[model samples]
Target: MVRRWKRVMAFLIAIIFCINCVMNIGVKGTYAENSNKDSNTEEVHTSAEEKEDTTEIEKETTSKAEKNKSDGDLSVDKNEKTTNKTEDDESKTKAVNNTILDWDTYKSKTTLVTVDDTNKRIYVKTGEALTLLSNCSAENYKDYIISLDSSVTGGAIEIPFTYDGYEFKGLGTKECPFEGNFNIANIKIQSTLFAGLL
Candidate 1:
């Protein structure tokens, strides 16, 4: 019975090899026929209209390049003015309780909402608004703590900014609920629980 099984396996292998050889020959013939046809085909000639179109495209591209160059010069002037304004703002800023405060403008008597990078905290002064940096989302600072400073009992923190289409309603905490909508609730507490489970 073992000898019979070995003979059958050898026969199947031989048949598969013969089938592959036949398929290869047929594919080679098809490719050779296609190449011969391609060689005998006529060359394409562009019309006068096509040549004019190509020139127009080139002209449009050159004009766009010139416009971009002019825009770059305007951007350089804008950058200079921006740098001067930033230097002025820095000179006017004052540090209080290890947090940088931008006293340029504040709502009512409230202070500016500033980020404490060292302690990974964001301080939101009551009645003042907090607009996060560009390309930043609420989930980006999930680990950072929020410190609210309110002189009045009913004073609320307003977040009226959006980042990359994500609205900044607020990240509500149990102690200090948000005045408007919120995307997350007590992210720190949730993260702590998840870590404990792990």
Candidate 2:
């Protein structure tokens, strides 16, 4: 009976030992799996942070590029405006230079004669005499006489005058009657003849 009881106790001890071993193994496996899961979560969090950082960096780069492009466009626009204004000013200066009249050549061919307070006469050589008046009034003796000989031929003439804030150009031919009196008012006259013994 004593030996049988000893064998039974020994078997129970062995069975308890096996069960404790199995329980320890299960606990270790559970701990290892939890550790691996934690490591994977840390890796995922780290990757997400890196992705966010890259996205921010890309956005900043794009913003900087856009700002630089806007600045470049503004500079180009300013340069174009400056160049256009410079060209416009140069063209206006050229136009003003072109419009300046040369008076030296005109003075050699013309003579001015003052008649009275109201009448002034321009006498060319046997061609046409241009008359100038100070006011818009016509009187009998206020007329201008241009004397020409019978041998003078006929040609075209231009008479320039200013009256009432306007400039006037009178076209005449020397074939018109010359032994007559002419009247002009409010005018400064310049006459040129193309022909006729003048």
Candidate 3:
């Protein structure tokens, strides 16, 4: 009876030891699996953070480039504006310098002659007749006579004819001749002369 009780106790102790060993192995395996999962999660989180940082850096670089481009465009626009103003000023100066006549003088000296009036065509028996001609369609003719304020010397009078709308003017004496085809549209004929009439 004593030997049988000892064997039964020994068997019970061995079964308990095996159960404890299996429980310890299971706990170790579960701890290892949890540790591996934690490491993988940390790696994934680190990669995500790197990507976000790269994205932010790229955005900043793009913004800076855009700002620089806009500044360059503004400079170009300013230069163009300056160039335009300079051109306008030059044009105005040219116009002023090339002004044909003083308006007050032009109004005083200019005269119109109509084609129908025989009196409009000045017939000078003493000096060469200065004839004004035009190819443009006729409108009205006002006599523009700038006769000598005083008689010229040597039995010859130099009569000045200032016509407003003539394309050509003739000035000639029996001794010497002078004629000009002028662009009447551009020139303000301030003064001209007729000499040596029949």
Candidate 2, residues 1-198, lDDT tens digits: the string is 999999999999999999989989989999999999999999999999999999999999999999999999999999999999989977775554334223332224344322332443323332222322221122322334533323434654334443222222122223331222443322233643221111
Among residues 3 or more apart in sequence or in different chains, the pairs in candidate 1 whose N, CA or C atoms overlap within 3 Å are none
- Model 1 is weakest, by summed lDDT over 10 consecutive residues, at 189-198
Q: Scored by CA lDDT, what does every candidate get?
A: 0.48, 0.48, 0.46
RMSD for each of the candidates:
25.2, 16.6, 17.6
Q: How many angstroms is residue 74 displaced in model 2 relative to the true structure, after the best TM-score fit?
A: 2.8
Per-residue lDDT over 1-198 for candidate 1, one digit per residue giving the tens place of the 0 to 100 score: 999999999999999999999989889988988876666552223445567788899999999998998899889889989999877655544222123223332222234455555676555553224442211333334555656643323433444443222233334333333333222232222111111110
Ranking by TM-score: 2, 3, 1
| Colliding pairs, model 3 | 112-141, 112-142, 113-141, 113-142, 114-141, 127-196, 127-197, 128-195, 128-196, 128-197
Ranking 1 against 3 by lDDT, winner: 1
Clashing residue pairs, candidate 2? none
Give the TM-scores of the predictions, in the order they appear.
0.28, 0.37, 0.32
Cα lDDT of candidate 3 equals: 0.46
Tens digits of lDDT, candidate 3, 37-143:
88888888988998899999999999999998999899899999999998987777555434433423322332421222343332222222222322111122222
Q: After superposition, which runs of candidate 1 have C-alpha atoms over 4 Å from their true positions?
A: 1-46, 94-151, 154-198
